[model samples]
Target: MYMVLVRTRVLPGDLLHDSYTGIAPPNTYKLGNKLFSLKVGLVEIDGKDVKLIPLAGPYIPRVNDFVIGKIIDFDAFSWDVDINSIYTAHLPAQDVFGREFSSQTHSLTSQFKVGDMLAAKIIAFDRTKDPVLTVREHGLGKIVHGEPIKLSPSKIPRLIGKKGSMAKIIETKTKTKLIIGQNGIIVVQGPSEGIVLAARAIHLIEEKAHMPSLTNMINELLTKEV
Candidate 1:
């Protein structure tokens, strides 16, 4: 695989790699023997594949992506949640409290008041329908406390780093727990000072995601924060 420098600006139609070198992945298209970029962003090469990492774009919901959402509205059996996307996600009562809703005995508002924030997973979604969300999985539920920090959705993987190394470092140094939502919301929890530091670190990652040696830079920042 050919290695391109991190943060290398790739414009639409820019030659990323020849067909003989690597397969064209997302954000790229192949034309005859050449792979070209389809977006203006940084280059990422994985094995024998080449793709562009978009610098800006709207979040498109995908199944199984953990997300943080705010309760927006509610009906008899489901609640509308703002998942920081163009599409509002729906969380059925059954998916939340793990039981069918009974009008005589259950009240959705009592469980999830409007504006309440929760961490959930996208259970289903398609272009033709709204996304369905669930908080039934372990470690998925109400975010009782913490500050919510938003970042560009495309920068999530860089914030997480390889195998979560960057996240682990920030958590350890700041003495905080970071609940990262792929939808771009991050909950930072710890002592007031630690939470502040962790939030800063997360923003740093978002701003410098495409830079080289970002992990080391974040590590240094965390060290100084301590």
Candidate 2:
């Protein structure tokens, strides 16, 4: 007699009596508006995965997502970068920024040089093959100035936080602009003092993403006036 709401994407015991219709003979029900099937065998909810049910969420890159990369090797069109996964990503000179060129056209080596980093977005992929990337936009480019800090690439989710609340808060409080790379590099810029505060806030968020009171904790830290 377990019933799940048709539109709530409830896994068991999620209080679905209102969002659904009809009774259950232990029957699998259709997911309705704003809901999706949580077909995964079982998942942790509130710290424990006791029941198998439906949930609502979106797919994000995990373990290894094949990514396109840019060459930093001056002479070669290919270079390597981590793609938030176990496998390293390669971006060949031709594919480094992704555009076929005439041999007479400018060589990629001239376009991208050593010490240059590229910002790219994931396009498509085949795990067996290298992932494709593109940087054909204003925000994507080789970082020219700013101090960089390295962090655990996996911790990006916590750094970005739900709905980007964490990042927004830091930017607002410190008045600094930040660029977070999927590859674990972060760039912060502002007045000398503000940049320092931004860096500390980012590091703190990475260290405390799991804490239940993250927002309040960060607010208190940022208000300390250095």
Candidate 3:
């Protein structure tokens, strides 16, 4: 089995596997032993399973992707969250109530309601299925008092910087703690003035993510008196 991750743009009907690999994953179809892509996307080969990541469009949920979401609606079993994506995600009652989960008796509103903000991770997702979220990991849960900022998901890597250099500079200068969501949502926790400075730097990074060597530019921004 090839363990290499093949990351290349593939168009619809592109040949993915010539022989039996595994069941065709979402966005792909299998005809006998041959597999083919069903859409234009970036391909990822997981064991023998092929997965696609959209090249252009709104945010598509991927497992392990940390995201910030706002609770939009709820039912007896789960809370529906809007992660600035096409479909609303869900945080199940079992995820919150643990072994004692009982949608009939346990109140979902007592834990979260519409308009509540949360820091969660996508535990399960398929192009055809709604994303599933969980806050069981460390540093994941309700977003407390802080300034929330939004940016394009494509610019997340630049915001983090090489080895986190860019993010470090903003934190050191503003004396703030940053909670980053790969889905483009961010929360800056610090003094009011520091929060402003941090946000300024973040937006500057977004505007100039294509530019090389941003540390110096950020240094200048932080040093400039507001």
- CA error at residue 75 for candidate 2, angstroms: 5.2
If candidate 3 were superposed on the true structure by all CA atoms, what would the RMSD be?
6.4
lDDT of 3 by residue, 1-226 (tens): 4544667678989887777456678778899988888776677775676777543345767899999999999988999999988878999988988978987789999889799999999999997899999999998888868998987776777788889888988998899988888888888999999999999998997776655567889889998844
What TM-score, over all chains together, does every model reach?
A: 0.89, 0.62, 0.75
- CA lDDT scores, all candidates in order: 0.86, 0.55, 0.83
The most accurate candidate by lDDT is: 1
Best by TM-score: 1
Worst 10 residues of 3 by lDDT: 49-58
**Candidate 2, position 6, lDDT:** 24
> Per-residue CA lDDT of candidate 1, range 24-132, in tens?
5777887887788888799866546455788777899999999999999998889999999999999998876566568567888888999999999999999999999
Question: What lDDT is reached at residue 179 by model 3?
Answer: 85
Clashing pairs in 1: none
**Residue 138 accuracy (lDDT) in model 2:** 56
Candidate 2 TM-score, C-alpha based: 0.62
Model 2 segments beyond 4 Å from truth? 1-43, 46-71, 74-85, 92-100
Root-mean-square deviation of Cα positions for candidate 2 versus the true structure, in angstroms: 8.5
